[model samples]
Target: MENPPGTIGPGWLIKVSSRTARPDPGACPTHLRTAVRPLVAAEPPVPFRRAPREDFAPGPLFAALDLWEQGGWSIGRVLDELRSTRGAFRGRNAPAHPSLMAWTVQAFERYVAARHEEQAAARAAGLPPTVPVRLGWTARTKKKDAPDARGGQQYEHTAWGRQYASADGSVRDLWIPSLGRAKADRAAAEKAAIAHVMANGAPTPHRRRGDTPPEDATASTRLPERVRVFDFGCADGSVTPLLDWHRTEVQNRFMADAAPAFVSAATGAGTRPGASCVDCKAISGCAALHRTPRLWGAASAAPMRGRRSVSAWDLRLHGECPAQYHLVRQLHLNDLSAENDGARRGRAVDAWLNQRHADRPVRGCRDLPIPDASSLPAAHPLEGPLAHVAVRMLTEHRVLCPLNGIGSNEQVLVQHRVTAYVPELDVVVLAVPDLLYTRRGDWIWRETKTASRPVWEGRSLLRSYPQLALAVLLFSAGALDADPRRSWVELEHLREGRGESRLERIDPSQPAVVAEAREVIADLAQPLLDDASYEPTTGRHCHGCQARTWCKPGTAYVAEHPQGVGRHPDAAEADHFADRGSIHA
Candidate 1:
């Protein structure tokens, strides 16, 4: 069936409400009805670059709220229905709240009078039939006992119920309560209710159906020259008056001089006191705010923060800086471009190794199958050097590593992904060992890195090797044995054999092992765990960070100290900077 012209569709009934808090250093609400923002951004998520929308669902409270605002029903009939029927998904309905019920009654009476005046105008103008006011709604009731202890009963709507205006649809006896929760519902409630309540002592006409006249058929329904708004707090009963649409225009013009400005709390970029600061997700580690809000108490800190899985890379990136971690690892806003030669070389080398090992294990690099370099890519410029480096690393490992030879009965895994939940830490640990195998009955988990500096060159390998520590934690946890190979974690530096291809056997029995690993995880997660404050640490590492272009500190530092053709990182380091958290979350 076609909808009548001017008849409001259910979809267009309620505007999408968001947490639009008032910008401070602006005009305060003279009457609260003028407020447009909500208390929170709990707007239903929508696709990026799309307008926010909320599906209209009309049950009891929804129907009651809408119908009263639109002048489709009187509160008396609604209350009777409310007594008999139960509402679905009931929350904040305020069934026994006198303020809610009174407001509903007063608003409904005002809406009916204003609507009737419009009908009268159409009749006087001899225009075509103007659509009469109708309510769009749905209703439901309790079918059975609710699963939970509280019996969930609802006043289910049964049919398309409606009420019409009297012949003389003029101003009505409307009163805006000086006090109560009488503020406007930003989306659904119309201004007609405010129009009536603001009018002083307008004669409220009793409602009637289209065909029948009211008990008192002689009510006036003339349109008023102006409408007003009011505010009512639950605590105080005084109704504070607000300006009508006409008055609001002036405030809009005044405020237009300076638009409200908002800055990311994480950046500590704003000076104006914002009402939303309390709920701002980026408030943690805010230098301007100088506060760090934590989620759980010290008692639940470890378990709560570690509940969600994080990778070895996640721990490492966070260890560097929480702000960088938030950008590269957490939000993934700074996906590094693969245009660098080093990145291409790393990919080519990785692809070659995986293909070579996945086919059949070759103990010697000379026996390893080499792929045609032309088939790789035009973008991969370091193909020759990358190939040579791979061969050197493979040969060195074959000669020095105990796992160079293995029998068919021996267990071995290549390029295998390992994930294990650390019970003590209460966080999932993920690591992909390039070579995991048994050598003379010794189990080892090894990682290969083609970096400028090898693992063995570092002064304190343990201090320099947080990722290795995580690898050991995952390896030992995945072993299923109380302790495997006394928890061995190795780092294979594939930088032309400048450093020793060494392995560090960690003792899981040592309290420090678990303590240190947990500390690393906590350090990486604490900022995010606390309040998602990813503040920039402002350090030297910011130089080549691809994401630094978008970071606050990086941008600030660059703005302050502009330099010559600065550092251009070689291609090989590109893959190292990419914060690909482990395979699993």
Candidate 2:
């Protein structure tokens, strides 16, 4: 079948990556649609060049597997070859970091051991021996059977992962590798991937770009009796089987069930303008995204830096410790540690409130009855005293629900992305208010925060909650396209106790308010933009820093401060229970 035409819209030859075809529950519907149905631009968007370490593990790891399959090389020989060549396997051009090379070598050793153990177990059970196969499978629906079935659209489904097959082709296994801890894939997606591969599975291996397929590059005559999917943990060398399905299960249950969802995602409409806008092919004409240039009021003297994004959370982290921001935000490294109780409670409360406010017909929470602690769902994050606290916080939210004053026809966007760009800084300023609504054509930004303690006494609201400061600047600059004279930025602080919630509204039209917001933002953003070296600054944030394991300075500081307490008088006295949640939430 020919590739889809270079057009962007809901109906077209939809190309779906079975792995990401169905997005998470709260993911942007527009993003999924756009991705599957991309416009054929004259000049395709340039892919970002990630750090060398990010690409190190997977390439060498797969190459080692191929080498093992071809030559049956010993583990020691494999490691020696890889180390000697510095991972120039498969003609890789990018340099590998020394640390990453060491990590990958260890990962390969673990992977081989795990693979051998699995093979041994299979042999003991009288199953045929397995061999590594690199082929990817694709399942396609005829143009007549596409989402717009009658409109002549075709859909192609494909899965991504390491592949293996029994010598007799009785069983096939898809190994999904993770550099860190093994995480479970979404159930629907996993099933869909299995269905896709099984429907058109072949013994052929994956070919690099421009590589010619073998003479027998066709679907396997005999389908595997059993399909297995495993998530391989490279960090600790653990193998977790995620799915085991018979051919009947894939055809009768999984395929029939997943087809509709896959179609719905591909045909999804509506623009959700946020981080996705940065790379969206249709962004130039997207009316959904509101761009406010220079909203941060901070310009970088270095104009050569590529475009990047900054949020209130980024600002706060950079303000506290630059290294934490870089490691956690930029490199996307994590220690896989559990969050503290207070932080978890805050998230639970926020989720609960968001769910309630998202109800149809624009109903307010003022009249809704609060749930009792005992009735809370087991799956709910709230538990014990924290459940009670979350319940109480919900009760406090009743009085401050933004929907109370909103009309049914007025726009109500809950946790919607509001973005701005700072051209001078060559950075995007991103903000997602907890709730945004309009009254008589005036835009109102509401940020709901859960705190165990009351609002910090005598502290500037903008200083305490920098999101409100960003909100103010956005409204002042007319980013939201509402009446600037009446637009307001609101902070609804919900405390644990009854009747302790505070609702403070700032008039963004005022010059003084805008000045204060600008100052607050600049104070946090200037150092982040100007500083190239993200040096670690030890303080209270290290206690909750997820990237501490990767930062020597942070690790040392944490060791010295075993109690996770800060010695700084000002920060030590700061309210630690406050929620520093993500606005890209």
Candidate 3:
């Protein structure tokens, strides 16, 4: 017997239970019948009475909407029903605006229009029309006619609820998203979607130990294939696979274990508060997090707004930690910082570089002007000692920098932003360079990275960084005349006032270089299209993560990992991709 995972109610259920017992072979050997034994003592017969039915109390339309989601209704199916009876929808949660009602209705309109045209074409061709089935949240099953009768009558009712099966009734593309709801919670979407996925009839490959064959079968149980679920923010009725629930082999094994540590799983506090617990409404009720004051900081923090386009910073953070990415980007948690003071200071220097370069407006050997503390705007935080440090770094770069005979006469594009449309990825690729200048009529790009450790010790490591690799393609495909042999992109490290003496050259003309460059960029950019692909990879960098207090895995890793928190080697380089300032905020 076991209690369901997130229940506050008193509900217990047998772990391995069946509605019917082992069958008797005498009645029907092929399809076994329920076993029956002769009664020793017969009791007085009682009048037949069916189970009492509760009155259907409609609270609001949103409640039914939620129930349909939990019931695994397809997007088209749910929207079609909703569109027909929107005016008569019960409940206070019905949309206040008519436009809000059109969200799913629009999607349904397209589907219906396409179907009508398909029917017309089929009729003209003298063929049968293929009408798509809009399945309701019910399954047809045979019910026992009498107490002793076995599977005599069939009726339509909910068993586990219908998953969003395809037109041909395939379970492969089962996905449910909370559409067109503005205050829609991520947790609620996950709960509704995952429940539907589990029940949607994906066949599991694994079998139970105490299983029986058809000869002695009662309940014809089969392993349900694993169902993949995607949770997207602001889904807009589109099931974009932006993120998915990826369980490690260990996690899978643990969940599949016959005996699991229920107590530990239930009351177990997170090793450390992470993005998952930041705005958790149940923290006060949770005994594990109630005593932890450090985690409380996240709850006080605000959230971030949604994004119109994706950036390198977006990809990197989402790759590093999906939870943190959601908190920073989806929630717009601006008050929280993802990087430490030193890395943030480096970004401040980048801003200073842009300002300094803009003043010269030339491609020759130039000097970076130091900013005066008094000259900073009221919003700019770099003042006093911080301002002095910024000036000192600029001065140090002027003297120690090794740039003299690199570019001939091409104009310099400081803080240059280059964009390319990648149709395969369904989004534009953003390739921003610190300084972009041309050589031999080909644009040469140089990116300044502020890191405690050298980003790339050797030239071989240049191919590994997609920001540079992607720039090669973005520049070549454009009118920039980015010749592979003449033009090159360099990664300059801005630690202790040192710049790249020799830049890494890109041979864009070479078939190998072109193929490799696009492949690398595509691999990174492609996953962003799907919501499920954004999974968090916990590592030593978790210690310095600003969202660490909100990340459970991050905290657990900090406590259990060998790196032991603080500043990791990859921290600075990874954070160097902050949307570089454009002189203004």
Candidate 4:
């Protein structure tokens, strides 16, 4: 029997994947502990249920790749075989989208082209032909002085990617696949891969500890002279060599730098409930998580509706274009384009405020030093005119800080994930306010936004910022465990210069405000809930759409309007790729 949660047995191992080991400035440390640590029980463990996806799952794509490479089947034949295998490409209990077939074909062709290019380049360089191989590296070490119940720790770094080697196994290549454009690997993850590649010997078939080793297992453990990461793009079927390291370069690096981080990931504590909460097994005992029920006022979904998460951003994206929502948000296909200036400035301002709000002793921004273009904090780097504008905005925020008059004992949460579940809708509604602090006993939800221009006088505030509408609804529904009469929502609009920022407060206690908030949210959300096809609608927003490369209508729209005339300056700041609600508000 395995030990209970937080107690490691003798068989327990502290293993970390490249994905889990990489630096995520926003990641919850407790999440890392739950993922890599070995204290989980074998019996009915903490149940974590994820929403069923209607988008493409990569299992079938890779499986098809295997059939094409190992079984010597043609691409068409592999896809046909894949289609015949029902439930193979699906997610959870949901069926795969029909568009995935086209995506798979494009991805497979790209893979083949990448391989051909690799072989050609090798031949040109007078290198021998290489063949694909099933190779994995697991670098394990036993720590002398362990922390928990276990006497020692087995620290493991596993390499996950497609592998290829020369006939003599002297040269090897690791191909990493991405559904969209290939991007650079995280520094820590790249280093971990190097450590794994250098520490392990020749590849062998995986088996149980007591199982006999295969006769063909190579004993000649020779380190390759060269290691390269070939990043394959499934969206456009392009392959880019992301990283190439010589053996000397790998040997020169210190292996000890990664050790402390590995141990810390296993032993780290604290909870941050956001996107990770949806799949967290330790959520039951997490005190940091604040749950609010029936916050969205969504009607009861039909029987057998798979649980899903909803956020203000989701409704915003769906309203912009449903196809963009499905392709960018659900499918997660991006062209790796740079964000526009307004969005970047807003993000910088958000970060700066969050940092100030998160300071110890629960102080306000009233006394903080204003930053200039050169003196801005290293974490929130802005440039050119926007940097100056951000500085002025930061100055304006001093008076509007929620902690200014609040009692010392009052709670202050900045950029904290606020989650609520609508039982009727089978949906989890998420919101992350710029600042959430308490005065007396009432909760104050503040949303800060930076804009080149001021809020249009004609538009309703609720329609201008839908998040406030959601906030009003949540607080009015008693989501924060406080009296609605005392609690209210705030929108702080910061523009360049002193005394120009406007702070608008909405009383959620008022029936008129509550009704308007409901209508604002429902008008945007109802169409999304009813959407089944997610058809593309052509507009100027398509020009800035990240997934437009794969969307025909969006592509056509962008092509016709190459000048990018009608794209909203603020829309560029919207976060289309955030797994949960972003601090972009």
Candidate 5:
């Protein structure tokens, strides 16, 4: 019988199908294009390539698997999902299929099981389950319970000492052999040795007389019966020796065993006979007066031939400008050049003269003309009255005033009125802006040269040594009668410039000058006697003061009130302990 039209014989089926069917698009392109064709019913499933084991390490792969397993996904479920989301054949050449999925699932299961084992091991070791316990007081509490009779209870002290219950239920100390008393004994011995050395060390001079006897046996015995002089700020001890000689001379002249009463008076002591006593030593006497002037007489009188000789002791030089006495003893260091812009301008002009004619000697001229009375304008409110008062004061004192003038090279020249004195040999120059003398008794004013440009335009000279001025004032007022001419001011200029020579002059003031100088001397007298109100005026003048740091009002006030700020109780106790123990050494 003939077969149906739709049916084909089995023998012909393979050849006919192979000849009629189209190539599968899903087949590898390279294999499909090759000359040889496979005689198969369907394309063989493409083999997946496994990644090199070295490429993905076991650790990271295992971790990733553990994460997936912990999230409630089974190995097969995760693999299927991954395959659906990302094509099965993801590699360039071939699919990384079932093999990769199986390996990943196995790794995940192993990682999860390993992690659980690790947690169990940690718990077995008595470690915290997850979080760590903090160390310190929080980790433990102090036990107050006592041991019972059953067995024995053990307790630990903060110092790590142990206590154990005895057979009778009483607690007994469990000695730790390592903790010996030797260490504490050694430390105590060292401390004791240090303390003993300190106690036997030299003691500081006690301020209280009763605590320590005076070095000088006659300190109390030589009370007001002797006159004592103190020369403070005695630079180079120039005036000290002279005062000593003078004291000897007075003693010889009077043939007296004690200092003259006049000497006590000059020292700011009352004239009362029994008010004060003088120490034979100059420094001691001065210190005594500074400390206790009430015991010293206001006025010290020298009895020579039954007549009291005028004498004074106690010379002091303080402040930055000790050379001030050089000017004030002869001429006042007025605010004239200090205050007037014109005067300052003139000084600048003088500075230029100094630089231009450094080699040429310039003489300072005195007695210049004054401004015409008519040229002066009518008095203004502030300046006029001040000028009038100054002029009146000057006129009353019969002092001559000078006029301003312009010198060669457009330099302003003005004469300064002053009392003249003979310059002394071996004199110490103590200030800048000093005066130089010419053959004709004319005075030339000069200033010290500084590396920096002058604050005023002209070259400036050190005028007067403030220390010297103080010395002179004190000496002339008989403050250093016991140590006269033994001291003077010392002026030091950093570098040499115009008029660089150092000069010195005796503190001899003219009669009229001395008269006016006495008034100033009196004004400053109280300060030497320890008047608290006697503060040095603040200004540029304070810039060079030696005691500026300690004497400054603000600093002094703060130093006096340190306790005003709250202090910790512990700190206070420490300080108290330190203070008490300090003297023991």
Candidate 6:
């Protein structure tokens, strides 16, 4: 049998093949050996030191290395012992457990020995060894000024010296591998773990022993003194962690100082009133007076009107200009067919309601046992005329009608009003339908009889503005009415049929909120009015506009702002000219 190219004994030499290097038939052994030598010599096998049996203990490799260092074993002896204990070396297929231990221990030992040797050599020559000096890592303290050489103060590794100086001044880098990349991965994992804990309370890889508080526990606390107000879209929850840390630190400090009094108070032991009271003052004065506010109150607040016009004119103008604000307000209705498995579920629901009412004759009803319809009828109704009406209103009036556009465009106005007598609690959720209302509030949710069924399941369908806005308006009204607890607005998406909702609880004093709400409402109401100059904004909406054929602005806008619209018009023109020239040439 003939051996393959670049093979010497059992080992193979990886090399580039060439037509000229092709072996001739009946080549001599001497010629073959000559051909393979250069290739084999070009690439040498990597030589690695092995670890001893002692290093292969269950503990971490570093710890094992530390033990070996203390024992003062020579490098050669250690390698020999490791090989004998772990079994004969099997090249690449060797078990990782022992190999990892050996690699780590040997690497550390070699590094230490190399440094010692270098030092000894320097000392013998009567010269100082090149030892690393501590130099602190720099951090950005302020904005860059043109002439400032030292940008910011740095945190130095006082013990480790310049050898331990991280690329970034962050201390976390020193203990981890591929500092930035590893830290990022670990951070992402931690964030996901925290979110999991919040959503489902699942155990995470970061789970530690003992009673350690969560990273976000302090921020989650309803304490007054540690309260720090933040604005919307403030760098993706950066302040939340800081606030949480600060809160924990403050609480820990306070508890440490007043430990005796706190323990005494908890045990009902006799304690000086003034002493205990002084420590409790901060807790008592907390702005978050109420821990859990009335859920009903939070639910009743009116929905703030979003800035999107459901009118035709606004749609047309939006189709033309497609401004950033317009894009922000624009609602993209999910394809019902795709979303609900080709059922056209919304339309089917509407049809059911329409058919149920078609044959019913008007009659006087005094008293009768209301027919039970579906499960959970006692709790609320399902698949009834009311549900049909909501579905119809959403699909036909809201979805089909160009005038109504998307209901998301309609601004649900909300106000944080003082409804209760609580002095401390000022924030409340309020859900309002339209701005127009009477003194006692308008009738929103009215009880209507279903033709086919009597009693339905689940809560009543919010038939009117008052009913729809009940969760936001009334619930929030009660929350703000008293100073008992936290307040938040819950935007329920009934259309998705998934029962998914978004909650945004904000401080009452947040200035941007009211302004944002006002803007949304103004945009939504645009289509309702007679705006002659209303042109279709053609950015994102042009693709979805039902009346795209009739929309002149949509056509013109797309033409003007082609895909990949660059800031420099001249550059775009030049590119176009080049393309044309290339095609001709």
In terms of TM-score, the best-performing candidate is: 2
Give the Cα-based TM-score of candidate 3 against the true structure. 0.42
Name model 1 segments beyond 4 Å from true.
Answer: 1-309, 335-343, 361-366, 369-403, 422-426, 454-458, 475-482, 497-528, 559-585
RMSD of 2: 5.5
The TM-score obtained by model 2 is 0.76
Q: Report the C-alpha lDDT of model 5 over 1-585, residue by residue, as the tens digit.
A: 111121222111111111012223222222221101112111222223232121221223333443353455576665555345322322322222222333334434443454355347645965333221111010011222542331112211011111111222211111111110111111222222212211111212323312322344223221111111111111111111001122223334322321121111112221111111110111121221222121111243221111110111111222212222111111111211122322222233233323323323332222322322232233211144433432232222112111112233332222111111111110111112222222222223322212111122252211222223333443344332323333332222211133322332433344433344444434333233222122233333332222333233423443555553332222221111110000000
| Cand. 3 Cα-lDDT | 0.40
RMSD of candidate 5 to the truth, in angstroms, is 49.0
Please state every model's RMSD to the true fold in angstroms: 22.7, 5.5, 25.2, 5.9, 49.0, 32.9
Put down candidate 1 lDDT per residue, 303-373, tens digits, no spaces.
Answer: 33313434556655566666655545543333233344445555555555545455554453345443355
* Winner of 1 and 4 under lDDT: 4
Q: Number of clashing pairs, model 2?
A: 3
Supply candidate 5's per-residue lDDT for 174.
Answer: 15
- lDDT for each candidate structure: 0.39, 0.66, 0.40, 0.66, 0.24, 0.26
lDDT of 3 by residue, 209-231 (tens): 33211322224333223333332
Error of 4 at 418 (Å): 2.7
Q: How accurate is candidate 6 locally (lDDT)?
A: 0.26
Summarize candidate 2's per-residue lDDT along 32-122 as a digit string, tens digits. 6656653333123333433332333476677777777666887788888777764356555454433344455777888888888988987
Instruction: After superposing candidate 5 on the true structure, give the runs of residues whose Cα lies further than 4 Å from its correct spot.
Output: 1-464, 473-495, 500-509, 528-530, 533-585
Clashes of each: 32, 3, 32, 1, 66, 70
Per-model TM-score versus the true fold: 0.43, 0.76, 0.42, 0.73, 0.19, 0.18
**Native-vs-model 1 lDDT?**
0.39
Least accurate 10 contiguous residues by lDDT in model 6: 576-585
